[model samples]
Target: MAFFDDLSHIGFSTKDFYKSTELYEKLGFELIDQEDNLGSKVNFYQINDLILEVYEDKTNSENGAINHFAIATDEIDKTFAHVKKLGFELIDDKIMHLPFFEHGISYFNFYGPNHETIEVCQKNKE
Candidate 1:
């Protein structure tokens, strides 16, 4: 059996592509490309190696199992500052320290477009 390597990309359905793109951009993602098919729209953003695909859908229901997604960063503070400057309110003003994780690692949550909770974290250097 071939073992899986890693997650290469993730897709999120949104009603507003412009709003979603703006929110992702504030989090350090850059708009890579977009596609339009039969009146449906899809936008793609790249943050380092990770690719985020946002699809504009009108029939998507509000209730979903997944609360949000996360993106790892080396410079959490700088990323947080960028998000703050874009007018996004952090869920907590303090950084969360997890004993289970590596030392110096910190994380905080913020709401994205449509109030989607996004967890941004930094891992300690070895």
Candidate 2:
């Protein structure tokens, strides 16, 4: 049996959809579509296979319970460099090889707009 199919998407909250869209676009995300009727402050973005949702709700705190999200890339350095060029804050200067489950992975974390942490990881080959 297949343990899992794949990650379809992850939802994240934001105070302003337009601002969040701008931030994500700077970080290499493309604006796919949005629902203006849903509310004045709700929208979504599609970055490759990832679907990021941003919602505007003053009642909800912007702390974002979801601390971080990650993307797997074959060219980690190139991807990291592109992100840096976009002016996003790199949290750690050094990449780390973390041992998890039955294998090890190399990754680095960075801060995105809205104080959200984003991780880029490359899995080690056996």
Highest-lDDT candidate: 1
Query: What is the lDDT for 42 in model 2?
Result: 59
- Provide the TM-score for each candidate, comma-separated: 0.82, 0.80
Candidate 1 structure quality by residue, lDDT tens digits, 1-126: 879887777877787668887777766689899899678898888888888778887787772124777789888788777777778868867667665555667788887776667788787775
Overall local distance difference test of candidate 2: 0.75
- C-alpha-based local distance difference test score of model 1: 0.76
What is each predicted model's overall lDDT from 0 to 1?
0.76, 0.75
Q: So what's the TM-score on candidate 1?
A: 0.82
Per-residue lDDT tens digits of candidate 2, residues 1-126? Answer: 898887877777765556677887777677776765455565677777888777665565756547899988877778877877777788978777889646788888888666778899988775
